[model samples]
Target: MITLLQNGAYLLNNSEIIEANNEAEAILKSKGVVETKEEAKQNTMAYNILKEHNTSGNMEKLEIKFDKITSHDITFVGIIQTARASGMEKFPLPYVLTNCHNSLCAVGGTINEDDHMFGLTAAQKYGGVYVPLHQAVIHQFAREMLATCGGMILGSDSHTRYGSLGTMAIGEGGGELAKQLLNQTYDVNMPGIVAVYMEGTPSYGVGPQDVALAIIGAVFNNGYVKNKVMEFVGPGIKNLSAEFRIGVDVMTTETTCLSSIWKTDEKIKEFYDIHGRIGDYKEIAPGACSYYDGVIKVDLGAIKPMIAMPFHPSNAYPIADVKANLKDYLHECEERAKVSFGDKIEYSLMDKIIDGNLYVEQGIIAGCAGGTFENICDAADILKKSDGIGSDKFTLSIYPSSTPVQMELIKNGVYATLMEKGAVMKTAFCGPCFGAGDTPSNNAFSIRHVTRNFPNREGSKVQNGQIASVALMDAKSVAATAANKGFLAGADEMEGVDFTKPKYYFDKSIYETRVFDSKGVADSSAELVFGPNIKDWPSMTALTDDLMLKVVSEIHDPVTTTDELIPSGETSSYRSNPLGLAEFTLSRRDPEYVGRAKDVYAMEVERREGKAPAGELADAYDKVKKQFPDADAVNTALGSTIYAVKPGDGSAREQAASCQKVLGAWANIAQEYATKRYRSNMINWGMIPFLYEKENLPFELNDYIYIPGIRKAIEEKADKIKAYVVGDAMTEFEISIGELTDDERKIILAGCLINYNNTSK
Candidate 1:
C-alpha cells in the first residue's frame, strides 16, 4: 500500500515520520531529531549532491553543471549538429554517444549506418566517447561504466536514471545537452523534495516493476510528485539488491518526476565495487531531522505483481485483479479506445478473450528495463522449469541490454535454456522498447517488459488502420505467459519454480575493444563526415510583431505522446535531416498534418519572399486582416498550430518539438503539457506553448487566428494573449506561459536555438 503524506513531513533520525504541521514545534517535540532544520536540510543525499553541482549562489533556484552527459544514436547527431552551429570547438564535458536505438538499419537503407559513422568521426574530432551499435543500451552503459555516487549525469534519453547506483541522473531533451556542450548550466527553480519511506520486504514472485507500478499508479494521475525530486529512504531499501533498486529507479520517469536519488548502503557500494570503481562509492543518507515537502510511504510487502494495460504506463492493475475481472477491465480499454482513436480504426481488447482466459500473441523481454542480467536469469529459470511452452500462435523474444550481460548469460548456460524453450535471443538493441523492432501483426495483442506501451509505440501505423495492443508486465510475468503458450498467467500460479540468484561477472574488454574513447584528446584536423541524408538545418526567421496561425490538426485526446507527434521506429534514421524528419511529423496521429502544415509553410515562404499569397491561404490572410483591424499583413507572420488536451507525454526526443518547428508551426494550444522536458523542447524550438482550457469554443481546424503585438507581449512577459478568429468576431481568451528563462525568451524571439546562437554572436 502506498500512502501520501500531503501536508509534508519530517524524518526523525530516519526512524519515524512526523507531520510537519508546525515546523519548529514538530522538530523540538521529537526526540529522534538531533539536528537543526538547516543542518538537516544539508544532510539529505540529494541536497549535498545538488549543492555541489549548483552554480547559482542561492538554493531557491539552481543552475546545475552535470559531470557527464550521454545520448544515443537517434539523438547525438542532432545535438552535435546544433552545438557545432553554436560555435563549439570540442566537448567541454565527457559525452558518451551510444548507437542502440537505430541499431536496426533494416528499414532506412544506409542512413542508419551513416549516423553511426558520423558519431565515430565526431568522437574523434570533438573528444567525445562513442559506443558501437549493439554494444550496450544507453542507460545500461552509463550504469556499468559512467555512474558515481554523489555525482550527477544528464542524458538525452527519458530513462536516464541511475539513482539506484547512488548517482543523480536526469533525462532531458537534446537542447539541454547542446547547452551543456556549450558549457551552459541546466537552470531550474528549486524543486520540492518528496520523501519515499519504504519498509517490509516484498513477497516472492514480486519484482521491482510491481512496486514501481504501484507507486506510479498511486501518484501519476494526481500530479502528487510532478517535477519533484523523490528521495528514497528506509530500512526496506536494505532488503533490495542493487539490480532490483535500479529497476525501480528507472521506471520513476513514468511518474513525471524531474529526477530521483536513493539512500546509499553497502549494496550500492558493492555495485560500484563490482564495476571496478569502488572509489566512486560514497555514503548518502538523510539527516537526523531532514524535512520533506511530501512523503510517500511504500510498504513493499503489500505490492503485488502488476500489469499496466494498453495505451499508457499508468493504466495499471494487479495481476490477480486483472485475471479475476478480465471482461470488465477489457471493456474499460475499449471505452478508452473510443475516445483515443475515435472512428479512425476499430480497436478492441475484448476479442482476445478465449474460453474465459485472456491470451496474448507476443511476449518480449527487451530494452534497458527488462534486459538486465538478474531479470533475464530469473526469466530463464522460470522458462526452463515449465512443463512445456507450446509454440503454436505464440512467440517470445529476449534482447539483452549489453554484450557483457549476454556474455554472462552464455557463461551461466541461461542463454541456452531460454533458446531451448523456443524463445528467440537477440542482441543489445533498444528497438523493442520504442517501436523499431518486434512489431506484432495488425490488431494483435502483445505483452512486454519494455518501458512504455503508448499508442503506435509497438510500431503499428494507426494512420494505415493498423493497431496492436501492448500490456506491460515484469520479465517474470512475461515468462509465465510464454510458458503457458500465450495464455495470461501470473508467476505465482505455478509451483516449485527455481529463481536462484546468479553471480554476475563484469567484462570490460568487450567495450574496450570495440568502443572509441578519445579521453579528452581531440584531433582538430580530422575531417567530419556527413552522409547525403545528413542535411543542415534550414534558416529560421525572427519572430514578427504580429502572428497568424491556421489550426492544422486539432486532437482532443487526453494525452498525446511523443511517439505520435514524431514516430520513433523508421523515422529515427532521418533525425540528422530536419526537413527529412519533419515529413513524418504527426504522421501516425494525424495523417494529413504534414501536408496541411506544409501548405501554410509555403504561404509563409511566399510572404517572406515578397510575393503575394495565393489560393485559400491568400483568402484566409485577407479575411484575418478584414476581421481584425489590429492585424496587418506586413507585420504578421503566418504559421500553423495544433490543439491537444495534453501533448508531449513520453520520450525526451527533441524531434517532437523540432518536427513541428521545422514545418513552420508557431504554436501548440493545450490544457497542460505532459512533461517539463517536452514543454522546454517546444520553447527551445521556438514554438509557443500556449496553455488554454480544454472546454474552450474558440478555434477549429483550418480556421485562422491572428494575435496582434505578439512580439511586444512576449518581450514584456504578458500573462494573457488576445487572439481573433479570421472570418468571425474577436474571440479573446486568457492563455498563459508560466515562466521563461532569459535564454529561452531569446530563443523564442530569434525563432529557434540555431538562430538565437547565430544572432547572439
Candidate 2:
C-alpha cells in the first residue's frame, strides 16, 4: 500500500515526480525552479511566518507574540524551575500545567503529586491555568480549551499538534516554553513546507491508525517530513472528520515533522461549533500557487491494518501478513524481542500462535491517538457482538481521550457496549503509552493502541532485569484480536458490524468548571512553591578554547530515542532537578554512564575552582601545559564528559539534552541531528550541537576531542570550525555548524539560554 522513492524526487509543476540524486546537484540545477528539496530547504513556511512577525527586527532571530504557552506534568516542573532560576516573577503569558503523566503518584516518594500541588499553588499565585489529575491529558485539554484559529501556541510536549483546529502549535522542550514565559519569541530559522497530498477514502476497518502508520512508514526512515510542516490537501479532505484528522496529525511527531496543518472545511467548523467556539473557525488553505519542498502522497484506501512491533512506531507491517505468515513474522518478532528485551527476560511469540491463531496476552486502546470518540465507537462496534469468545489469557482495557469524550461515550452507549465484553475503561491518562499504567506480566505480550512502543515504555523495568513488551496496533484490530480470544485478527476480518459515523459533542463545561483559567493575568504577588525534589539548574561554563571529552557511552543502534537516553517512568519525578535527573542519563541503556559522567563532572568542578584537575589526570594536565605554555591563555575552560553518536532522535524532552549538560558534557558530536527540536535542546542547554561530514569518524568513545578558538568562533559567527581529538597525540577534525541567530550565538556564548536571557534582563 506504499511506494518508496529510491532517491530524492522533485514534484514538477505540482504533478510530476523527477528524481534529484543529490542535494548539491539539486541545488545547483534548480536555482530558480523551486521544484525540489534543495531549492525549498532554504525557504520554508516557518521562515515566511517568522519574517512577517519580526518584532526583533532581524531575519534570523525571531520575536513572536504567542497567545499562550502550555506544559504537562512531565515538563512543567522543569520549565518552572528553570524560569525561577532566571529570576522569573509571575507568568507573562497564559501558562497551563495539566496533571496527566505523573498523576499516578503511585511511585517515587510523593515527588509526582508534589509537582502537581506545586503547579496548583503556582497557578493561584502567578495566574496560570492548572488542570487537576484525571481531568484530561495535556494535548486533549489544549485542543478543547486553548486552541483557536490563526493563533500560535508553544508546548513542551512533542505531541502538541492542533493544526486541524486552526492553531499553529509547536511541540518543543521546556526551555522553549520558559523562553515564552520570559517573553522571548521562539527562535527558529523557519521550517520547510511539505504538501501532504491525501487522496482516496480509507475502506471500513481501516481507521486513522492504518492511515497514520502508512504515512509514518513512508516518510520516517527517509526523513521526508523532518523539521517541516505537513500541509494536508486534496479531494480526500471531505472523507474524514476533524477527530480522524487529529488522530493522524498527532502521530506526525513520530515522523520528526516540525508541525502540521490541514485544509479546513465544514467538518472543522462543526468541531469548533460543537465546542462553542464557532468564532475560532476560519478557512485555511494552501495558496493555489503555494509551493512545497516535498509532496507526500497517501492513498488512504490502500492502507491496511498495521502493527508496529515492539520498540518503535516505524517498524510497521500489515496485520494480515503477520497472521498469514505466522511463523516467519513470529520469528521476526522474537528476534526483535531479543534485541529489545536482552537477557532481562525470555520472550517467545511463536508459541503463542497456536493452531494458526496468534494469542495475544493483553490488549489496550488508550492515549491521545487511540482513545478518541471515533476510535472507541468503532472498537465497540466490533466487540459488541463477540460474547467473550476469546480465551481467558486475553484481557482488554479502554481509556477515553478526555472526560468529555467519556461522558459522550456514555451518552451514546459506546462505553457500555465495550464494558459488556470484559473491557475495563480507564481515565484520561498517558500512562499506558509511557510505562506508567497497564504493565504486562513478565514475558507477556501486549498489543496496544498508543503513540510509541519504545523499549520499557510498557512499564518493563529493564534495568532491574524485568521485561514486558508491546506491539502497536489500531484500536479496531486490538478489539478484533480480543474478540477472537487473543488470536491475532485484523479489523478487516470482522465481517459485518456497522459503525455509524458519530458526531462528537464537545462539552467544555468540565474545563470551564474545574480548570484554573488565568486569562493572561500576571499576578506578581504569587510566591512559587518548591518541592523537596525540586532544584535549580546547575551552573554551566562557557565553551572552552580547547575541549576534552570522554564519550561515556556509545550506542551503535540505528536509532537512539530520548526515552533510552534518560528513560521515562520513575526518572520523571526528578525532572525538576537537573542534577538529580541527570543521574538517570543513560541509566537504562548503559548502567555505567552515571558514574563515568560524575567522574568527568568532578574534573570540571576542580578546574572551575582554579585548581588543577585532581587524581591521575593531573599528570595528563601537566603534560598539556607544555603545548600552550601559558596557564591563562592556553585553555580557559574545562568539562569532563561528552556523548557522540550517529544520531539522537525522538521526543522533545529537554531532559535528553539537559541531562548531558548537567553531567558536564561540553558537546554532542553526531553525523546529523534527527530533528530540529533535539538540536535546539542541545543549544538551549549550552552544549555544542557539533557535526562532522566525514563518512567515518577517526575517534572512538571516551576519546577526548578539543575545539580551539570556540569562544572566538561564537563572537565571529564562523560557520567553519576546527577541533582536535586528545589522545597520545592530538588528531584534528573538521566540523560545521548551521547558521545561528545572533540571539542564539549570544545564548551559546553566555553559557545557556537561561543564562543568556538573565544577563540581558
Candidate 3:
C-alpha cells in the first residue's frame, strides 16, 4: 500500500514523516537539524546533488549542464539533424546513440537501416559513441557506462533514471540535449522535491513492477509528482536489490515526474563494482530532518502482483482483484477503449475469458523495465520449474536489457532453461516496449512487462482495423501466467517458487567487439551519407504579426498520449524525415486529422508563396479579415491547431510535437499539458502552447481562431492574449501561456530550436 501526503512534508532520518505545516516545530524537536528553512533545504539528498550541478548562481532558477547525454535510433537522427541545422560542429561531451528502438528494420524498407548507418557516420563525424542493434537498450547502457555518483545525465528517452546508482538523470526533449551539446544550459525553475519514503520489505511474488505500478496508479492522475523531482529515501532502501531499484526507477516515467534520485548504499556500490565501474560509486544519503516538497510513503510489504489493463500503465489493479471481478474489469477496459480508439471498431477482452478466468495469448518481458538480469533470471527459473509454460496458442519471449546481461544469462544457464521451457529469447531490443516488435494478432491479448501498455502500443494498427490489448505485469507474474497455459495467475499462487538470483558476469568483449567509439575526436573530413528518405526539414516561417489557426482536431479524452498523436510501430521508421513522418500525425486518434490540417496548411503555403487563399480557407480568412480591415493576408500567417482536454501523457519523443510542426500546426490549446516534456517539445518546435478553460468554446472543429499581434505578445511576455473563435461569427475568449523562460520566448519568436540557434549566430 502507498499513501501520498496531501501536501509537502519533512522527512526525519529514521523515516518519520512531518507535514510541511509543522516543519518548524518538528525540526526544532528533531536532532541535528538546522533552525532555518533555507539551511534545512540544503540537507536533502536531492539538494546536495543539485547544488553541485547547478551552474546558475541563483538556486531558484536552475541552469543545468549534464555530464553526459544519450539517444536511441528512433530519436538520434532527428536530433542530429536539428543540431546540424543549429550549427553544431562536434559533440561537446560523451553522446551515445543506441540503435535499439528500430532494430527490427522491418518497416519502410531500408529507411530504418539507413537511420542506423546515419547514426554511425554522425558519431564518427561529430565525436560521439554508437551502440549497434542488440547491443543495449539506451538507459541500461547508460547505467553500465555513463552513470557516475553525484553526477547528472540528460537523455532523450523518457525513462532515463539512474538515481539508484547515485546519478541524477533526466529525460527531456532533444532540444534540451541539443542545447547542452551546443554549450547552453538546461534552464528551469528549481522543481519541488518529493520524498518517496519506503519502509518494510516486499512480499513474495511482488516484483519492482508491482511497486512501480502501485506508485504510478496512485500518483499519475492526481499530478502528485508532476514536473517535480522524486527523491526516493527511506529505511526500506536496504530491502531491495540494485536491479529491483532500477526496475522501479525506470517506471517513474509513468508517474510524470521530472526526474528521480534514490539514497545510495553498498548495494548500489556493488552494482557499480559488478559493472566494472567501482570508481563511479559514492555514498549518497539525506541529512537528518530533510525537507521535501511532498511525500509518498510506500509500504513494500503490502504490494502484490499487479496488472495495468490496456491503454495505460496508470490503469493498474491487483491481479487477484481483477480475477475476482473479471467481467466488470473487462467491461471497464472496453469502455476505456471507446475513449482511446473510438467506435471505429468493436474492442473487447471478455472473449479472452475462458472458464471464468482471464487468458492471454502472448507474454513478453522486454525493454528497460522488464528486461533486467534479475527479472529475466526469475522468469527463466519460474518457467523452468513449472511443468509447462506455454502451448501452441500461447507464446512467451524475453529480451535481456543489455548484451552483458544476456551474456550472464547464457553463462548461468538461465538462457538454456528459458529455451527448454518454451520461452523464446531475444537480443537486447526496445522493439516490444514501443510497438516495433512482437506484434500480436488482431483482437488478441498480451501480457507484457514493458514500460507502457498503451493502446496500439502492442504493435496493432487501430487505424488499419487491427486492435490488440496489453496488460502490464511483473516478469514473475508474466512467467506465472505463461506457466498457467495463458490463464491469468499470480506468481505467489504457485508453489515451490525460487527467488534466488544467479551471479551475473558482465562481458565487456561484447561491446568492445561491436560498438563504435569515436574517442571524442571528430572526423570532419568524413562525408555524411544521406538517404533519399531522410529529407531535410522544410523551412518554417517565424511567428507572424497576426495568426489564423483552424482547429483541426478536438479531442475530449481526459488525457491524450503522444502515441495517439504520432503512432509508434511501423510509422516510427520514418521519424528521420519530417514531411514523411508528418503524414501519419494523429492518424490513429483522428483519421481525418491529416486532411484537415493539410487543408489549413495549404493556405500557409500560399501565404509563404505570396498567393491568395481559396475555398473554405479563403472564406474563413475573409470572415476574420472583416474584424480587422487593415489585416493584410501577407502579414497574417495561416496554420492549423488542435484542442484537447489534456495532451502529451506518454513518451519523451519530440516527434509528437515535430510531426504537428511539419504539418503547419501553429498552436495547441489544452486544459493542461500532461507532461513537461511534451509541452517543452511544442515550445522547441516553435508553437504556441495555449491554456484554455472555457466550458463553451465559440469554435467547432475546422473553425478558425485568430490571435492578433501574436508575435508582439510573445515579445512582450504577455501572459494573456486577445484571441477570437470565428465560426459563424466572431466570439472572443482569452488565451494564455502558463510560463515561458526568456530563452523559450526567443525560440518561439525564431520559430524553433534550430531557427533560434541559427538566428542567434
Clashes of each: 0, 4, 1
Q: Taking the tens digit of each residue's C-alpha lDDT, what string does model 2 give over 366-461?
A: 888889888999888898758963547788988888899999999888888888888999899988888888888877789998898888567767
For candidate 1, write residues 73-114 as lDDT tens digits.
999999999999889999999999999998877767888899
Best candidate, TM-score-wise?
Answer: 3
Tell me how far the alpha carbon of residue 649 in candidate 1 is from the true structure, in angstroms, after superposition: 0.7
Per-candidate TM-score against the hidden true structure:
0.97, 0.92, 0.98
Score candidate 2 by lDDT. 0.77
lDDT: the better of candidates 1 and 2 = 1
Residue pairs in candidate 3 whose N, alpha carbon or C atoms collide under 3 angstroms: 8-293
Off by over 4 Å in 1: 22-28, 32-42, 613-630
Q: Highest lDDT: which candidate? A: 3
**RMSD to true structure for each model, in Å:** 1.7, 3.9, 1.4
**Over 4 Å off in model 3, which ranges?**
22-27, 30-32
Worst 10 residues of 1 by lDDT: 24-33
Q: What is the TM-score (0 to 1) of candidate 2?
A: 0.92
lDDT of 3 by residue, 200-294 (tens): 99998999999999999999999999999999998998999999999999999999998899999999999999889999898998887778888
Kindly report which residue pairs in candidate 1 clash with one another. none
What local lDDT does model 3 show for residue 71? 96
